[model samples]
Target: MASSVLQIVSPIKGAPKPIGPTNKKPMRPSNQLPQSLLDAARAIEKVPFHAEKHVTFQPPSRVYTMKEIGLEGCGISPIATSEPFQLFSQEAVQQCRAEIFSEPVLDKYQFSSTFTKNMIRGISAEDAPFVHALWKSPQVANAVSKVAGIELVPAFDYEIAHVNVLVNKDGEGEKAEDNVGFSWHYDSFPFVCVTMLSDCAGMTGGETALRTGDGEVRKVRGPTMGTAVILQGRYIEHAALKALGGQERTTMITPFRPKNPLIKDETVLTTCVAISDNSRLFYDYCLYRAELLQERMRLQAQWLREQKEAGAPFDTASVKKFIEEQREFLDTTLEQFI
Candidate 1:
C-alpha cells in the first residue's frame, strides 16, 4: 500500500456548523439513566492502568484505503478505515467504565447534544486517571497510528476518551430497520480511535457507514468489547448505525492529529464549542495551536538562518507562504472562541 499523501483543505467543506452558543453551559440529559445500569457500571473495580497488562494491541484484520473506498486524496492519510481490532483488555475496559461512572465524572462530564443524547466528555487526568493514562499511553497511540498510517497524537487533552453511551431498556429500543446513532457528518478531528466498552455479542447492525466520494455508501463493522476501529473521519462523511438488541452500547472516542508540527492541521471546533465547556475548550484549543505555531516558527527561523549562512538569498515566496499559512491557522483558532 502507498504511504498517505497529505491533502490540505481549509474549513472542510460540508462539515457541521455549531447550532448556537445556547449549549455553552453543559446540557444535562433529558432523561436519567436507569439505576440498574448505573449500578452495573459503578460495580467494576478501579485499577491503575499498566500498559503491559492493559493494552492488547493487535492489527486490524483488514484496512480500507482512500483509493479502495473511492476517496483517494481526500484526507491527510491514504487509509480510510480499519476493521475492528483488539486494543484493550477486558480488565482495562472495566476500569475505564468504572472511572466513567464514578460520581465526580458522571456529575461533571455528562453532556447532552442533538448529536448524542447521553455522552461523557471533558474527562481529564484529574477526573479519570485510569482512562486518561490509557489514552496517553505511547503503546496505545502507536497502535492507533499504525492503523491510521500516520504518526498521531491526541488532538488535545479535551478530546481524550469522549464516551457515547446508549442503553436500551428491556431491548425496547431495538429497531427492525436500520437507524442512525449519530447523524451523517464529518468529524472535527483528522483521525479518531473509537474503542468499544460494551459487549456486542447480542448486538446487530452497529456498523459505521461512510459516504464515498461518488455518493455510494460503504459500511465498516463496529468494534466489539475491548476492540477498536480507526478512521480518518475528518474527510469522510460518515454516521454511526444503531445497534439492535444490545442492552448497553458505550464507545470511547479519542480524536488525534498528526504528530509532526509541520503537517497542515485543519482541525475545527465547529462541532465542539456548543457541546463543551467554553472556558476549558478554548484554553486547550488555543494552547495546542500556540504550541504548534511555536514549533513551526522555530523551524522556519532555523531554516532561514541556515540558508543565510550558506550565502543563499532570502526565499521571499516561501517565507510569504509560511506566514500566510500561519495567519490562516491563527484565524481559524480565533473563530473557535465564539
Candidate 2:
C-alpha cells in the first residue's frame, strides 16, 4: 500500500487538525441517557468469556471484493466488505453489554468526539476482562481473518472492543441525509470488525454505505445482534447509517492490522487523538511499532546470514532496499507522536 492511499481524510468538514491530546477534560454525552437504557444494562448477567460457548462463527452470506466494488488494486486485501454474519452467541453479547455498561467502564472510559457523540474506548483487560479476552481469542481472530482474506491481529490493546452508542428518542428514523452516525472517511486502521451489541429486531436502514471506486454508492446490510461485518475500512470510504425504530444502537468496533511483521502498517492517530487519552494512545502506538521494527530487523538479519553462509555474494540492492523501508517505517512512526 502506498503512503498516499493511507492519507487521513477528515470525516467532518472543517474538522480541526489534531495537535496533541485535545480532550483534556472528561467529556460526557450531551443528553441524559434514557432510564430504560440503563435499566436494560443492569439486567444482563455477567459471565467470564468462554470461546466454545461465546463464539458461534459462521461464514458471511456474501463478501464483496475490491474488484466487485470497482476498487481493484487498492487496500491491503482483495476483500472489501462482508454481509452480516453470525459471530458471537446471544449470551456472549449480553456479557459484553454488561461489561460495557458497567459503572466502572462508563465512569472511566466514556469518550465523546465530534465524529460521534458517545463512545466507550481505552478499556483495558483489567477493566473489561470478558471483552478483552473475546477479541484476543484465537477463534474470533480466525473467523475475522477468514472473512478478511488475510491473517490479522487486533491493532492494539487500547482499541479492542471500542464501543459506539446511539440512542434515538423519537420513534421515527432520521432522513437518509441525516442518518449518518459516522461521516464519510477512511479508517485509521487497515481493517475493522464491527459487531452489533444491541438488538435490531425492528430496525431499518442501519446499513453501511460504501463509496465505490468510480464514485457510486453501495450499501451493505448491517449486522444484527451477536453478528458482525468485516471491512477493509482503511481503504474504503464509508459511513455508518443510523437505524430507525430502535431506541438504542450500540456496536463494538475492533481494529486490525496484518499479523505479518513485514506487512506495511498504515495506522494513523488522526482520528483517535481527539477522542483518546493521549498518553496511553501514544504509549500503545509506539510500543507496537517498536516491536514490529524489532521483528523486521531480526528477519532481515537472519536472511543476510543465511545468504552469506550459502556462499552467495552480498546483495547490495536487497540490503539497501530493506534499510530504506525501515527508514520510512521509522519516519512514519515519528510523525504520529505529535
- Per-residue lDDT tens digits for candidate 1, residues 82-173, read 99999999999989988988888989989898788899999879989998899999999899999999899999999899999988877655
* Ten-residue region with minimum lDDT total, candidate 2: 1-10
lDDT of each: 0.85, 0.83
- Give each model a TM-score: 0.93, 0.91
Number of the predicted model whose lDDT against the real structure is largest: 1
Q: Kindly report which residue stretches of model 2 are placed more than 4 angstroms away from their true locations once superposed.
A: 1-26, 175-177
Top-TM-score candidate index: 1
- Candidate 1 lDDT trough over 10 residues, lowest sum: 1-10
The C-alpha stretches of model 1 lying farther than 4 A from their native spots are 1-25, 175-178
Model 2, span 6-69: residue lDDT tens = 1212222221232323454447778655777777887987788999999999999889998999
Clashing pairs in 1: none
